[model samples]
Target: MRVNKWGVGVILAASVLLTGCAGGSDKPADEKPSGAAQEENAAPESDCPELKDGATIDGAALSECVTEAMADSAGFAAKMTTLGMESTSRYNPAEAAVATDTTFGSVVVIGEDAWVKSATGEWQAADTASTDPTVVALSTAAKAVDASDPMGVAGTLSGEYTVTGTGTRLGQDVFLLTGVTEEGGTSVDMVFELTSDYVVLAATGSTELEGQKIESVQEITEWDVEQDIIAPL
Candidate 1:
């Protein structure tokens, strides 16, 4: 697919939210607790499968948990941030909305249509033909959200990772998993945060493209919440 600027930005944002920088630390340096206190305050160990340092995750179990959570939820919303891009997206399966702010300008997608807000503050239709990469990516992302298949994106990297019980996110205790992928002399690091229920709350990662380095972070919430998505007028 021809990756447009907007498409690349969205993909970068979504990927960062779904998976994080591979080798980054998840432990909060300032919040170290004693072993006794950690054990006392931690959720039951059974909540998460035991993961040895530097091992692959249990993909089947992880997928099962994510699928179950998605099946139980009504809808969800997500926010993504990168060096020069920020986006907020919401999905209810049948419909979705995404608003992105980039150094170039603002782009918004509502359902099948995409729009751009110019410097003069006029909203106009983006060139979102069926063959357009941005349109295809946005559509696929919405469908994935509707399917509640978080693993469809991150589950592909299910092996050889170190896991640690780490800091809180969105007020939920999480397990931080990190991994790396090397190709064409470039190494990308990714990190993922999973909640007690196996739900993925956030992901961040860094990679290089066209000789430029890109880093991104993403957060998702409102699982099973009632969300009504509408087209922008």
Candidate 2:
């Protein structure tokens, strides 16, 4: 896997948009909010490989779904593959320090630095660097549709997501992204965090590969951007 400088730059830049406040001091005991209730019902299970909130999604499984979706989608697969290769090459086992409700946690090796929020409000050095934007776009778009590839312009860039479970990357709480697709498939899953009010924090990837598979898993543990959250401009 080789890194594409141009693509990485674009994604890294876009990542700057993700910025928010992190907890510094501990909340007073009386003021601390209660944690969310544990889901009592079992997520709906199925062969469609949708990621439900609170469950783990296998990387290989995600790749298969992506590949299948991209079968006839022109060069989508190629782009994703390139990103996958790039990501694997640069996926160093490093820790990312970021804010949490209690203490700060790290997201390790979050897919080659797609961008992260640091103490300041700008993109900073992450465990890994980002892949090309084209690749990032294709993969993310595909995942949104619960489809394998970006065959048509029928995908969403943003939507509501619930945290079904959590995973640790360098001991940080990376939320497990899961929810049933309103159309087909079960719920799609990804490891993510809330970068800002609108952005979903994550590393770059070929998350949706050919043959409907997940080719890579990028774990993130920190953000190093350089702008202040109160005034990120």
Candidate of highest lDDT: 1
lDDT by residue (tens digit), candidate 1, 1-233: 11112222224344322222122223332343332223312233344455444446765445445545443445555555666455555545434454444333445555556665433355556643446454444434333332334323334344445675475665557778787644235565767776656556677667877777777666664444545654545
Candidate 2, backbone clash total: 50
Question: Model 2 misses residue 56 by how many Å?
Answer: 16
Off by over 4 Å in 1: 1-56, 93-147, 150-152, 181-187, 221-224
Q: Cα lDDT of all candidates, in order?
A: 0.48, 0.26
Q: Write the per-residue lDDT of candidate 2 for residues 1-233, one digit (tens) a residue.
A: 12221122122212321122123222221221222211121222324244445444544344333223222211111011122222211111122111111111112123222223333233333323246443343223212221222111112112343556644332223455542221122233323432111122232222322345332222222222121112111
lDDT of 2: 0.26
What's the C-alpha lDDT at position 19 in model 1? 27
Q: Ten-residue segment with the worst summed lDDT in candidate 2?
A: 97-106
After superposition, the stretches of candidate 2 with alpha carbons farther than 4 Å from their true spots are 1-84, 88-160, 180-189, 194-212, 225-233
Clashes of each: 15, 50
